[model samples]
Target: MSGSTFALRVAQGVGFTGAAWLSGNIAALSANSVPAIISSVREDNISPNVACKQWRNMYEAGKTQNPPIAFATASSFAYVAWSVRQIPRSLAASAAYGGFGMYVAAAVLTLSIVPYTVAAMRPTNNALLELAESKGDRVTSSAEVEGLLGRWTTLNWARSLLPLAGGFAGIAAALL
Candidate 1:
């Protein structure tokens, strides 16, 4: 009814939608794409260079697409927190506080994947990128590509969890 109420609803909707989309997108890469790339090497007898190139393409796509989703989701969650904080505490003090806290948590969790990618995933990413670009010059063996893909898959799954949790947090905020 009120403008702030409408804003909170909109923010919550955006936050939840974005989080779900982002998390699922990243997880799909980990679960499906990366594994298929790995299989292309191990089972399909594809060249390591080819597999590396495929991975690089996937990486580039995710790099271009995922960050914007993360930024939007985190921003929406933060906006939700801010909007909830503006509500008069006298009207519903406990719910307002709880919602604010949950929304803040959601924002933090959604944003954390950036640092996680930087700290945990970057080394493997760089190595794989170099191997992809090197076109067999840098690669020591197929095992190297396999190892890198496995590591990336694990790290990406971990990365997906943050947004998943953030989405759940946003849902909890809505219930509050």
Candidate 2:
């Protein structure tokens, strides 16, 4: 209900959506490789026409033969690429909706952190004020403020990490 609390909620919502979009972009780039991989996978004699007709002709002539070799000649990378390609279009489609969901979730998450941040800041601010009022005199109370700030910093960092990790996981899951 406080101004800071409201601001935190808004920030969280924005951060979450930003994270999701970032993830989606990564997934999109990865997914784009799928079509190429599919083409490459089919490049073998098994499906000469899976890719370009020019390559098919070369295959028929025995001039060159190998899977179109997407990602790399390495099967594992190829498989990873293929896996990336396999991410359902529906998921991507749903990502559009998921974006909104992320925003809401982020907002809620951020809002939840407000009270904790406020609590942390209160002691820190008090110490800071006390130190300032002392006018150059050393103040032991500054340590409490510093500690609270450190805790807040750690939590903020954690908040950032969650969306990043979640986004990557979502992308990986989609790829699989």
Give the TM-scores of the predictions, in the order they appear: 0.94, 0.28
Per-residue lDDT over 52-143 for candidate 1, one digit per residue giving the tens place of the 0 to 100 score: 88999999999999888899999999998998888777867999899999999999999898899999999999988888888445645789
Q: Residues 16-120, candidate 2: write the lDDT tens digits.
A: 344455334323322443234333544543222222233223223321221121111122222323333434567466653454444333333323323433564
lDDT, candidate 2, at 23? 34
Q: lDDT at 44 for candidate 2?
A: 40
Prediction 2 TM-score vs. true? 0.28
Instruction: Kindly provide the TM-score of model 1 when superposed on the true structure, using C-alpha atoms.
Output: 0.94
Model 1 clashes, total count: 0
RMSD of 2: 27.1
- Indicate the residue-level lDDT of 56 in model 2: 26
